[model samples]
Target: MSLDRRLATPALTTLLVVLIGLVTGCARIPTDGAVRDGTTELEQASEIGFIPAGPTPGASPDAIVQGFLTNAQAGPTSAASFAAAQEYLTPAAWRAWDRYVRVLVLDGDPQLVPEDLEEGATSTTVTGSAVVVATVDERGVYTEETDPSTVPVTFALTKRADGEWRISQLENGLMITTGFFSQAFHLTRLYFPTPDLAWWVPDVRWFPRQTWRTDATSEILAGPPEWLADSTTTVIPEGTSLAIDAVTVTDDGTIDVSLTSTITQATADQRALAVAQLEATLVEGEGRDVELSDGTSPLPVPDNAVISTPQTRGDALAVSDGALYRVVGQSLVDLEDAPSLDGLDPTALATGPGDRPIVVRDGSDRILRLSGTGVPDVVMTGRDLVPPSVDRFESVWSARGNTLLVGLASGGVQTLDVDWLDTRTVRSVRVSPEGARVAIVSSGPSGRLVHVAGIQRDADSVPTGLSTPVQVGASVDQVDVAVWQEDTVLALIGAEQDGDRAVFVAGVGGQAGTGGLARVLTGVTEPTWVTASVGSGAMLVLDGDDTLHARQTSSLWPPVAEGVDLVAYPG
Candidate 1:
């Protein structure tokens, strides 16, 4: 989602009044001075101007703890708010605290219980508890907790020499309410190029809205995250850094990025690729351009420099009654000039690179590749193979039992060894359109697990293995299928608890509620298969009754075609 900085009118007005009061209280009036007239100036206030209140003099222990928690919510976005929050803590405590360690998102306000101490006591402890819904690490990666539970928030307050109660000890990180987090931070994606530079892969991150542009650019230069490092590559030269501390946006929406002289060592192609990556990461609205410099000379971008966004063909592919057809405008038309599946008894189908159809035979469990000469060849065989997923590299992915196999278009098959998939039965496997990542659904002792990981490949872009998997949709207990709706969104066919099978939208980097398993379609009668087109944002699902349903804007899934066995978009 994009940045949402809107605040309620009434709330904004109230905050303005509070700020005015604070400013007036700190100003000193000169009553004896003569009235002198000068030019009057008024500056407009920023829409996001809201300074959190500082600690009150002689406040109680619980009051100080509560105030600290409230003010810390704005610490990530505003330096004034962070300074105000430090007022509630002792000198030693402020030094000991590390605000970037972790961010605990709470369901609501925490419960603070202060200890009853004698009137002369100098120190006391306050116990706090809140139900944590999610957590963000120092790198701003958000992970939704599978189960929400009450977590302790303890604080130790001591009376100082000035007869004021200040927090002396607390946790290293800050605790914030979900409402505050939603307003202060935004979920953004950093783009990186694949090994071959054919497509852009997204790496999700959370950043404070006030400094998102600078943060995003710095992260792009720092390289992709560990989980995605092997699959993606960067063109920026090593040791390249921002010449200045911040990235500046001009009045006309042009982004000016000045880099260190290390960028001078890059080749022309490398410089063009670097510019493409910066533009993709920082350009948000129309008419915005990213200009680069080395603090002296301007770096020119190539005229044909282009970074590819993952997109699929407009029409979808489906198999019905042992025949392959192209879905066009609610009608199934025979695929012309393509190999006929007349006698193959195809049950499932997928389109590889260049619209080549890969079919899975009904009873033989063999994957067949249809040639241009109307001949079908068995590429791989298994006891019970899932549907095939083709990547941009012309490699096909499918799983059987706990083993993941890739059928190379150049030659034989190779079995991948995924350490994290130990003993888990592979239910479904789908390669992303960018060919840099793969999504897998499996079942193990912990029930259904949906994971997305970067695809590791060799210098020739051949499948080698997968990076460490990151679990997605942790709350989904019965997931049967998972498809990529976009680079960072997944369409999952699963149910929570004992609910019926339906369509859920899951964000790759964790969403707001229920561990990213937000139900998009309810009352879907046993959705067995699903596919989505990234270009059109259209989704199709195959129900148990052999009816193909398409998603509409009104959240309704109307049947598009009947007696459909499988559906898929070009991968």
Candidate 2:
């Protein structure tokens, strides 16, 4: 079955079951169920349903507050669920509540502590507290709180005319447990186009299982996020909206998108780009297509229009003993027709589009471009320069301290302005595969920081500057290296709380705890260098002993090559 059908029927029913359990005052909701061993399916196939219950009469202030908190879990997804929860609150309090403001995901069940009430007092306050693991903004953007902290939740209740306790005052947003969050919300990717329209970049968003399609389509029309606004462009015309306010799938497996009259003003090229963006964002697996219409008339997309998918080169590049080689199986083979590095003492290497190699010389403070058969050309020279990275546009990117320098394809190098990295030393800089975003590792008063920012380019696709950066992997400390594992994910070498250095995976936008910020490998001794293949998620690391290791299916990092110094994949 298609993913949309699976989610629309089974997964959505599972969410409703969990929400109904919360409203019915179930003591514990089972997040996981037993599955048969050797099952090939990714998720279990089970359908469970329940009827949500409202508040019980004569309940105490503590029960009312607890019930209110539990029922609020459904507020972000279902209106009926929120209305059922409102029975525990007074009319004024319910009217004042705004569930769309934000959502706080707790580490576990919240603790309700009732304040000491005076004799015959008509009102009492119950204080709720829990360790927040993550938060969802009004835009449905999920930010994992790496440094989990305890936050206070307040609820004030009073006796109504029927002598039943009803909440009179409370915070605005919904508070849900992490278990509930995992079951109810899904991580979705919304695709945007690069300035040149050659590749698509993914923007991560979290939506409830029942409303993901509508939410994703609306967010696409609204444009990219704040930090990514300047780097990416959308062909969807301004002021365009969904005429029906919902995206529906037909029995023929086609996604029907009806737009407002504003889309009618867009040119044919604009419509084509819009269709490509929609297909990339909405179509998941094979055998699915997007059908667009401006309510009445069909908006056709050209059949021959193509937008290439971003991918790295097939083989990884490595430098050993002043020679460049390609990693093949368990051995390193000499690169064919490669430029000689007899006395240059190359230490780091990166390949750009068309297998163009750029190397950094040890102790020379210079980056050189190596052709098939010629002398190496000096591309960039600076003090304390990190390894150089070449983007798809063939522009070499390197950083000296806090300064960001880019070597243009036409000629001289340009110093791009990065106002956010003030006074901090840049450790590493890497451009995304599509050349739409750049990942930077830097250090300041708050230890090491990993940031991914959008790269702004002019009309001619020349490097201009960077947009505001969004920090990722905030929990990891003392980061030494950060590389792009995939379009929206990063591989980081950092430690947590002075622990041993380990390999961690973090999403581009602060998705730390929820299947992000995961520690993949540990027990490596004083690792110095790390690299990942963008085409395949393969990773390699160089330890202090000059031993090169590759990650296996398990946590083991077995030695792949001995006496290897540096390794990297094409950017």
Candidate 3:
């Protein structure tokens, strides 16, 4: 449906007026709240059977309460933790409690101090102050509320018939101290296919952290989330679902999944595609083999399947000096043959079909572009013009204050007809891989916060406007760069509360993986800039020392290249 070429104008006077006026509005150096508590480290859980048991049966009241809060709050997430938490509560209390009511996170464990609940009775309250960074609603909606009001979490006790003290009543919902979320819930993803079928798309989902090979597989079988409804496709047959609730991982780390008998009715190609989906989702299943439990068909992943993931080494491109280069490991291979970038000095770049999308500085300081096709003519002007992001529709989008300027491959310039433009300033913008969502750092009454908005494009892939904007979390104050590391996650490089530089990643419509903590990329601090591709394995960053580094999981960011000014990747 793309027409291949779009026309744009060379007007700078109008764009400059808006930029100068907004510069003096309010100068708050961008800073994310917290994440430095070692929450950024990635830890994978391989044993689902492990559970933190409570303190001994005859422990003191204060010890019993603290131990119960710690032992019972971990994963397999909220879904199954209730059954495990019953050990800490009386049988009657467990049955009447609602585990999903709300998650009350304390900065540290609840402090147990003697307080008078009744004139003649003794009570215990928080011994140490507690602060809640965020809250997850019943429907799993995550809200970043750094300073939510707190209520004392008190535990009541009683003596049973056997004369052993047990907790009779306690707060509902799962509870964990500030830094234990990663151990309680695995920040996992479900894979879906892009409309073009050339790339894979990952939709973020949180499962109770455990050896949950079945949790990841079942969610993938349920298909993509509603926000991604029309943007992505699933390979599983239309009605096919997981046939077994418990699939075991062999000692050798191979996963054999059993699908509903309905899979027998799928076509040869559908079956092959289904297996590809299985292979991608279960790659984190701590296993090597993803075979149909029915044992009728062979796993069919083509030699070159695009299994896009956040922690991956994806196709990365960069511009060194004035020439374009594809970052192949440590070497910068020049891609000078593309006619679109001839005779121009490129200052900034973004991901597109071939990494040809660039921002050229027309004057000594101006950076502008006319994007669409391999190369389109434009009158370049201004440095405030950040690199435009190319969405899946091939339509290019750039931010100027609150306005989103769109350049459709079909033709013409259009301002996104979105309503949020009047309220928030769009700092850095990155469209989701499926082109159905936009992750951006927006400023409103609450200052700058990271938000993900849904996009609505016309038939020709031209963006009309955005709808249903959702805040990712409240961990960061201002976002310098917001780019998609995978289809579901965005790698954020910004300042921390004290103005220290950090990198935080978040899912499109869920809690940050580290439970609202800013997951910092350890080795490199104050990176010059950060870049990531949609189907990438690693997040490439340029440190303040001019050293290029790549970070994936816990390993230190190994240097990739040197003398690199700006890094870029495919859209």
Candidate 4:
């Protein structure tokens, strides 16, 4: 939960530090070793998936990665040797490895040199294991090769599994630009299980130009054309690693990613970068790719945007053409004519009048009565009905005919009896398109307040349902009522607690729709609220500055509507 909050909000860059100094400890590859091509050997081993010896037999995976790194630096340049080393890569990790190796070693410019490499470093404590650190000598290459300089490099590595060791991080020691160069190392983390590859002295530092050739089966190793292994998924729990099959940005603002990689914590973190980078790009319009780190794109998002509630069938009838109607259904069978408050604000919608009286609440915390005669009479208006403790009207919805429920930011429910225009304190209330029901969110003194569909027979009696409060994502902190598809009740949940906000949709059915929470969209800045239009697949999210921001549910890309003024509904 805490981690989700950190990721959702604006935060510092994630750093990697292990691979930085991995080679420093054992600087030289074994002197007498032959550069045997282990390519065929690794390919054969990878055919059925790299299965190392079971529990009591082989060395741990980390030890294996270390062995490979040491061997690579020794003298072997065989494709087969590198293939043996490829066992530690994830699908995505492999791409990062391939990119790095091609750029820094095989096709390197040849002017860069390491000044030093650090070993025996410690990082954050992991689950039962500790994170380790390392450092490497950094080199700077002039474009024209006239002058070159050496820079210090540092890295952070996490010690995972008893046998599974991974080059969990990499970074520059200096913090002048991004302040923490660790993010650079995370690039290959999504692909490589261990950071082990030979270093080539480059004359100048420039982007590597080797292109990877991948099919459903064949994969590239440290550089392009170096076929490493063939597999659809790389499982690294034991001897396996993650691998990336393909990554491309479509013309329609969609990022299509194909993964043949392992699914592990390391892989997840690595994939998060790719996903974040893509999502950030969508959030940022044309010409601006989100580049968070030197290696990853930092996505720029506005501080906030307004979130919208879904428009439902019952609500749809009332909101079609911005006109109003009275809807009643045993199961959406009957809807009748209702009086329209043509000049009211969009927020003033709760219910309208027909043969059955409609209960309505407004921004003023007052319960107004709407009748078939097109007259809106005040039923209970003022502090007497709203109570002095209530702050502001966050939302208002109909529980049933002539019964209205009002939600306040101060955390209290107000039930208004429209027949006599009286008020009462209700434990809980849920307003569904079918009817209104009272519900209990939690049994103990502390829990999320739940509202469910129910009924009211008499002014003093209320019948509740079995439904519970909708369960939201772990990090969700707030929600607004939304009606979508007529039957589904949705609540737009704010997933950030630290002023960083993204919106999610939760069905307001039984148990608060625990099974129906969907991650509709993310990467919005200061998203105070959200609402969705069912017909157009569009959504409106409010920013912290009280602006109505609109976007489509299908694309969720940027060029979204910003700062829409909220005003009275025009007649």
Candidate 5:
């Protein structure tokens, strides 16, 4: 987003009028209905020194040129303004105004000049187009500078199909120099409909159907001619809005939020409302009042409620510490409860468990380790890296001293070991009871399915190859897969399209292997992990409800009240 002062404001004003002229004039000025003639209505207008009123043959070329000039200079605000400007030039001239003058000048003040020309030349060549050259001696009313710079400028005025003459080009470096100035017009109109729209999402980021507002201050600068703005208003779609209902802190200290209405599907109005609500919440903090358009009461948040960090014992979640620890008898401490994970360094750990959990303390440049006796114990105080800004591992398993694997966005796998980092591309990672493994549901560069290798482990060695990549037979509606047992279990990981949680299962890995992966349950909220009896066919399912459900592995999901914040099965 580049902002060049010369073209930022004045250029935008000019371009806006030109676009208005083209779109408005396109319909109001009728062309030869049948493509029966080689000369366009615009072409003929160029020859007569007039632009067409509508699209009459031999219309004045001057009229078309004047139309373009007037519209470019004066922002078109109505159909009449547009129609009046279409009379002076030829198709070529109108094309130039539409293509260059309006875009390069009105949209922005462009520094246009002849790049190349020949002597004894009645015309100059710019971008392979010929144009007449001259110097402007006139000056604008603004008297800031006593003298203005004089330079040669070129403009292409040509006859249209109908013999009408119009501007063909405006020679400016704007054709090449691009940034905030050149794209301002496009960006404006692109965001014009939802002038409040900040982004068109997915292409900008990866979420779909989401439009964001840059800020409450950015407004739609230009509107179509009066008639068009009114007529086309309905073209914009509606959006969704949300209202808060209740907020509660759970016994475990995690916040439990309940809403009377959240976005199920959004309309233009609903979406706008949602954006407004979100902005208010973000700026003023939660529970802020948001007025609705329908004259309903403003949404209010519950008092005495506060948001807190999530604490879970799910296999998908890892724990780290930021405290002092003795190498031989290390004890990990929760960074939140302790003074701070001040001096610990993850990379400098002399020795500890092969898969010791660690984390970089928030807002602090220290590392903490999670150690344990009966339960996991957090050991703080470790070595620090050289560069203070380098981000250390947020979550990773150390295979051996100085060797660790790091997961990253775009399904990339990074190995930081032996004092070097090597990146290997892969699909997303799926965390399971045993460890995190790469999912096989993704495609390789060759656009073919790849096979998944089974999990492997060696005595006294850190686990490796938790699951091999596999080439699935068909395109599956799944993002990740979870492993419970060697072959008797599997679960889905990550969020899905519908927003509702679900899990699929398969029995292909074990002896009776006929039940390949299949959908076993639906509407399972926040389903992230699973624990089942080896072959008993009974399983425990965890949900976003932060509760556990014990169900027959073969039956549809049903929650059992037996739940705990932390659960463990003895090896």
Candidate 6:
């Protein structure tokens, strides 16, 4: 990415023979005989290094250039491998190259085009064009830039005393070509403390698998990224950090997280937050426990603390005939007689996250909450308001033509200043379960696009701004967003290529379109609404006829409910 003039082409003819110095490398080749039963040879080999190979002495300029690029592998797991890469560079140029700055990951083989060599010139230009898929920085931060990146690399060369080509001048950092980014890095979610300190916001980050466990915990200690800086914080003591360099997960699945003594004498709430952060960041499989220590005593995660998870889910709750119903075994059981009932006219229901039904009263724009007591208590009261979308932080977020209102579960309202959504006509907003992201389905000059962003919150979990907005399905015309599948499944009501209304799934953070959906259910003419349960993985759709059909991961879906208009699931 650095295009400084000093890095442009200069000289290299005399050293052509040196880059031709392909050194002999040693390796125990893995054959069928090396693998017996369940044992594999690769399992025993260190994944972070090479045996140190270089282009042979007789190789051409293009081959040496390709070899230098494809073989240099300095990154999160192998920052020291650049030493081996130094074998290809002249001693002076190697000393000047800063390998820790940025690592460019290319898509496929780099096209090496040699320019017309000048008469009696030692150096000529070689223009390289390679698609850049992503880049990893020194901090281990990665960004996927799938645009094709082309760079004119200058390789000044000299014939060393041994009479061979050695790269005398080159740019800093390693250039990893070929589609190797996926193999070197993995999608990892680093947990950051939400405003309430009762839950965590999953900031999806990428880490090299070789150093993932260690780097993951360190990332947590470093706190949330810039987008989440306002909405999330660290519960670890202010000065506390990882005393050790790495977090070790034993073969038995026990995670040992060691921190400094700053947390040893911390408050009960602080200690509990520390444990929650560690467990969420370290534990991988079910029932695998996390052990935190300050290098002295074993500290366990507190049992009294509550991690925010919605108890009353939207998929299980339904409404019909001006009455409330809980769906059980495909039956709509009335809940009007449950508790302290009164005059409750449900006009519009807010979906996602809550232990009760949050609806806009028939004649009032005020939001009403009916839970344990069943007595309708006004939570958010205002005029000319739209139905609220219950966010994961136990807060309600509603936007009336870009004028957004965010109310907490406690009892207060904060109208945030969001000028970004003004250009587009805001239709509906749904927050993710992590309470850090907001999924908005809005219409603009380009038609309806799905935008997902981080919900920046104050210390009290009040909405401030929606940051890092990325329009999902930008190329697809989406009508409405049904629900989110935790971090993966994204359900939307859109038209298929043949012009038939259908439900589509774009697996967020992964694949796209029907390729991400488990089964294709088409011919739902004029499909309007969709919802999927986070707990059950059950998906339901409502067509123009108001008929409802259910779909899980399987192809077959029985009619689950009828006479239902609006539907949703917990965020």
CA lDDT of every candidate: 0.76, 0.74, 0.59, 0.29, 0.29, 0.58
Give the better candidate number (4 or 6) by lDDT: 6
Query: Against the hidden true structure, what lDDT does model 1 obtain?
Result: 0.76
After superposing candidate 2, which stretches have Cα over 4 Å from the reference? 1-51, 74-80, 117-121, 512-525
10 residues in a row with least lDDT, candidate 5 = 201-210
Across 1-571, the per-residue lDDT of candidate 2 in tens digits comes to 1122222322133233532212222232223321001112234333223344567788878888776765667554555667778898999999999875787876556778898878777899999687786787777787767577899888899988788889999888877765456445556778888777788888887776567788889999999998889888888889999999789888988999999999988888888888878888787788888888989577877754477666676577777877778887667898888778776767667778657655555454888888666677788887778888888888888888899988877868989868999968899999988898899999887778988899988887888889898887776678888888876778888765547666777776544233232344554566788877775767788888888888754356778788887788777
Better of 3 and 5 by lDDT: 3
Cα lDDT tens digits for candidate 6, 1-571: 1111111212111112112222223233222111011111122222223344565785545555655664464333454444545667778887898864776665444567755655555554456665554566765655444234666556656555665556777777656532234434555666776666556666555566568877878777777777667767777766777778888877988888888888776777777776777777667679776778887577755655566532225544555555556555555677545433356556556644544444443444677766666566677766645546677566777666566777677778777666667777666676776677777777777677776677776656667777766445433445555456545446677655556666665433423211111223443456777666654566666767666666643344556667875545554
lDDT of 5 by residue, 308-348 (tens): 11111212121233343221111222323322334433332
Assess the local accuracy of residue 495 in candidate 1 as a C-alpha lDDT between 0 and 100.
71
**How would you encode candidate 4's per-residue C-alpha lDDT over 237-327 as one tens digit per residue?**
2321223444334466444333332223334344443334233222334643322221233223333222122122322123333444422
State in Å the error of residue 366, model 2: 1.2
Q: Listing every candidate in turn, what is its Cα RMSD in Å to the true structure after a full C-alpha superposition?
A: 10.0, 5.9, 13.4, 22.8, 25.5, 10.2
Score candidate 6 by lDDT: 0.58
Q: List candidate 4 stretches off by more than 4 Å.
A: 1-56, 59-311, 314-347, 351-360, 369-372, 377-471, 478-489, 493-498, 506-520, 523-529, 532-551, 554-571
User: Once model 3 is optimally superposed onto the true structure by TM-score, how far is the C-alpha of residue 107 displaced, in angstroms?
Assistant: 3.0
lDDT of 1 by residue, 189-292 (tens): 89999888889998877776678888888888889998999999988888899898799999999899999999988888888888888888888879988888
Give the number of the best model, judged by lDDT. 1
Candidate 1: clashing pairs of residues: none
Clashes of each: 0, 0, 18, 84, 94, 14
The lDDT, on a scale of 0 to 1, for candidate 5 is 0.29
| Model 5 misplaced stretches (Cα beyond 4 Å) | 1-451, 454-468, 472-475, 485-488, 494-500, 507-517, 522-526, 561-571
Q: How high is the lDDT of residue 204 in model 3? A: 57
